[model samples]
Target: MADGEEVTLDGRPLHLLRVADLKAALESRGLAKSGQKSALVKRLRGALMLENLQKHSTPHATFQPNSQIGEEMSQNSFIKQYLEKQQELLQQRLEREAREAAELEGAFGAKSGDFGNLSHLEGIWVKFRRIWVI
Candidate 1:
């Protein structure tokens, strides 16, 4: 497998493991090992996905609180921070897109009235017609 490729729970690269290796890996995880090769691959992928979700979903020890109110407050703060960061990123992206659109319009001569004038359009049509005639 490639270096950037994802691995299984046992650190073995996915899509490169043989049938026996798959069975062994499933057995090690106490998962069902009885299935066809495709089924085995699907089961292993599902296990890997579930493991990743569980790892990411678990809160850090520092975030854990003894009191329920304290935990709720901490969670609320985290959520607010996350939302603000997302909104800032979105605003930056929108501004970048608007700048790019303006640049494209300038490059295509749209700001110089090249597209707004009928004479320029007729010149473009004449050039296009000449190209087809040749």
Candidate 2:
């Protein structure tokens, strides 16, 4: 934000960039690539600062709401209503998903039932199935 101030592009300090990366950036900007890492960082920073300045030169549009107290109160009420509606919808969706999951588990016996518990006397059910085809 100031002269000679280092900015990070990807969490790593700009001055700590690899020599090859610094050279690549310099080359891209059509700057001299024969300099040391510090010189490269300086050049890149200068180029980036100029670019930032150019970006800020453009005029930006800003929101201008009604200054009247009644209109401001209406805008606030509208925002509150929208947010409350979204929250209620989210709560309803969560409740419905939970209920559907519970119904599925009950219908499928996923949580409470286990086939291993309904055992016969030491493989009696297997024998019964073989003999009693009906």
Candidate 3:
């Protein structure tokens, strides 16, 4: 299969891998397998892509110069496509991470005057504070 190409099971995509098989693969890779099919597919794809990246290094030296314009063009196009896919994947990952970070910040961000145990009394406390206590 070409680089970045997804693996298929039973003519369907990798997501079609049965739950048992997917769990086995995840456990073998030391990953948590407690999610749904979509999550499993995502984890497996990321693991597979990471493995593929580790296996393949720079492809520049692998190309054999061909005198035919068509052959050279095809190889160049393939390389360009592969690089573009990798770039797209990286961009997507960056966006996902940024979104998660923003969510985490939103979850943990509390204003300075926010109360923890007496949250329900926040506005009441502000309204009933001593009038002369500056």
Candidate 4:
């Protein structure tokens, strides 16, 4: 609903609706890519579909290996385990991204790549504006 435009669905924003609308939208896209299984798509599609529920502009949502997410964070055993694993993965990724960002910063100080330091995301628009030209 952001970065991309949103359209009115029956006089209301499409995002105001339920998971059903999301399912329909995704299904309407057709053709599944090769090498990926349906189960993975089903869960991912479900989470993205659920994102329509968020009122906030920024995407605070992330995927758990087992599907159900964020506000719908599941209490199911498998989902719980998956969520814990995902937290660990997120921590590791944050650490890695921070390290990579530091390395990139040292190399060019944001004069080169988009992958540079981002301790303050405030300058993202400035960087992105520059980045988007290429």
Give TM per candidate. Answer: 0.36, 0.38, 0.37, 0.28
lDDT of 4 by residue, 26-131 (tens): 5565523332344434543444545555654575468456443433544466766775675556557667877777787788777435754454442653454343
How far in Å is the alpha carbon of 37 misplaced in model 2? 1.1
Tens digit per residue, CA lDDT, model 2, 3-119: 576676456777888988888877888988777888888888788778778888865557445546545544686765765565556556656655666687789877633433333
- Candidate 1, pairs of clashing residues: none
lDDT of 1 by residue, 20-116 (tens): 9889878987899998988888888878777777887867877746546644644686765765565556556656655665687778856634334
Q: Name the best candidate (by lDDT).
A: 1
Going through the candidates in the order shown, the clash numbers are 0, 0, 0, 0
Candidate 3 lDDT, 1-134, residue by residue in tens: 57677765445677778988888888999999988988998888788767777788666765657646545544686765765565556556656655655566579895433433343333434443322112
Choose 2 or 4, whichever is better by lDDT: 2
RMSD of each: 19.5, 20.3, 23.5, 20.1
- In candidate 2, position 127 carries an lDDT of 59
Candidate 2 regions with alpha-carbon error over 4 angstroms: 3-5, 59-134
Off by over 4 Å in 3: 1-4, 8-12, 58-134
Candidate 4 displacement at residue 22 in angstroms: 38
lDDT values, one for every candidate: 0.67, 0.65, 0.65, 0.52
Better of 2 and 3 by TM-score: 2
Candidate 3 vs 4: which has more TM-score: 3
